[model samples]
Every structure is written in structure tokens, then in C-alpha cells.
Target: MYVLKHGIKRNPEKRWALPDRIFFGYGACAILAGAFLEHPSLEGFYGERIIPGEGFSGNHIYATNGVIAFDYHGYSAREQLLEHHKRGWASRNPGWHCTIATVDFDLLDTVELNRRKMLGPDQYLHDPVPRARRFLRRIDHAEGAARALRTVTRSQPMLRVACTSDPT
Candidate 1:
């Protein structure tokens, strides 16, 4: 029975920033999804995720472009994403059943914007557009790093094979 906390206030003049792990969950998903919409291939969804047997439920906003789904967990195949959640939760709670119902992206975005306006001027929460952009940049940078690592690792086996095959 998770619920959104409202009326949290912050100093209007103070500079506010999102935590490093902001991509992990909650409203941050919404912001990230919104930002991801900039990519024409992606569509954002507001998902109401619930595990009825375990009495656990939450909202998980994410972006998917037919083939890939992206969220706090990063990129996954569109088909495997929800299944992955189910497996993870089921492991913790025997007989766990999870389901996600999607709502319109616009509706969720509007609601989030309204809620932020109600909350005082905490720059991190008050204005999501720029925050989302910054978050997207971080994601891109991380993806680049991961790709580079994978490339290096893949070449290692080849390098070892070449060294072993050579005779002095």
C-alpha cells in the first residue's frame, strides 16, 4: 500500500539536487520516462504494479520502444522486463503474483507536474524537464562505459588465443 507523500517543502532559494541513486525507483521513473519520450521510438507508460497475494503494490513508470524496455533497472528486452520483475518478487515471497496495469502517459505527467507545483520550490522536484535531461545524460554516459567495457572484455579472449597460438 505505497502512497505518494505530499506537501514536502524545501527552501525556495537553496539549490536542490537528486541523489545518485535517483534512477532506482518511485517518481524518478516518471521523470526518466518523460525525458526518454524525446526519442521518437520510445513510448512512456504509467504502470500500476501490484502483487495481490503478497499485498504489495507500487507504481513503476517506464519507457519501451517495441523491442526494449528501460527503467530504473536499465535496458531489457520488452518481453522479458515484466517477467523479470515477477521472478525476482516470487523468489522473495512464495506464491507471489505481480501484475501491472498501464495508464496514459499524459495523465501521469500532468498529475506529477501538479503535485510538484503544490510542493514548494525545490528545484529538483519543482522543474522536472531539466532534471530529466540531466538524468538522461547520465544514463547515456553509463551505457557508453558499459559498452566500452564489454568491447574490452570480448577482445581479451582473442588476445589470449593469439598469444597462446604463437611460437617463438
Candidate 2:
């Protein structure tokens, strides 16, 4: 506590000093300020590969907050969805130490190949009449992806259908 020293035997050198608690508060504030000033590491992070004009899987896989992530796109119209490994995955993800890594990129590459195959021999490139086989292939594939992903997520009860006849 500090008070006006009017008629007390006080030295003139250290007469006007802040309280001890106030000095300590300033010290703590300085330390917190330094911690946040440091930047996060972005040196070895791998770039994501996604192309435009490619096909969409249309299956929602993950969700966070109010955002939902559907199936990943295989190809892009502008550039390749996945590029060649100029550098290894080790360089990209330094702490990526997985013992049971079983995914093969070769199988994943089939997405673009399958899409083209479903469209048939490109017989009528100019003539847009009767492209039923190709049309059916894409439709069936999209439906299958949706159905498979739906198995993982449990749906909420129908809120608007409460008035329906079937109560079961």
C-alpha cells in the first residue's frame, strides 16, 4: 500500500514507487506476450493434391463443427489431383511413424481410369445421342458411394415425419 508521506521520516530517493503487486503483474504480462509472438512450423508440411473438372465421389466422410467433408475428388480439370513424389512422404510428414500402413496409391489411381472406362469407346464424340451405357455407369457409381458411406453414419429421427401414420 502507498500513501502520501507528508510529515513522516521518509527518504526522498525512493519516495514515489509503485506497489509490489503492480510490478509483478507487468512482469507476467511480458512473458505471455513473448510466447504468442513465435510462429508455427510450416517447413516440412506436404501440399494437398486436388484437381478441378475431375469427378466427385459425393460421399460425406468426416465432419467437424458445422462443416461436413464429403468424398475426396480423384481428378481435377486444371491439374493433377496427386503429383509425382518429387520428395518422399518422410520429408513431408516428419513425425509420421506408422507401422501398419497398408494403403497403396496404385489402387487409388484407378479412379480416373474407371471414370473414363464407364463412358465407353467415345464412339459418338460429336453426336450426343444415345449415350446410355456411359450415363448409367456414372449414376450407379455415385449411388454406390453414397450407400456405402451411409452405413457408417446413424441418422437422426425424422422430425417432420412425426405426424406420419406409421409410428414404428
lDDT of 1 at 149: 44
lDDT for model 1, please.
Answer: 0.45
lDDT of 1 by residue, 1-168 (tens): 122234322332222343533433544555566566655232332232222343643335566543346666566554455555655555666666644444243423555545533221133435655665666666663463355345445544322110011111
RMSD of each: 13.5, 30.9
Most lDDT-accurate candidate:
1
Candidates in order, TM-scores: namely: 0.50, 0.15
Across 115-148, the per-residue lDDT of candidate 2 in tens digits comes to: 4232111221222112222222333433543443
Q: Which residue segments of model 1 deviate by more than 4 Å? A: 1-18, 22-24, 38-54, 107-126, 141-168
Candidate-wise lDDT, in order: 0.45, 0.22
In angstroms, how far off is 103's CA in candidate 2? 2.8
**Which runs of model 2 end up more than 4 angstroms from their true locations?**
1-100, 104-139, 155-168
- Cα error, residue 19 of model 1, in Å, equals 3.9
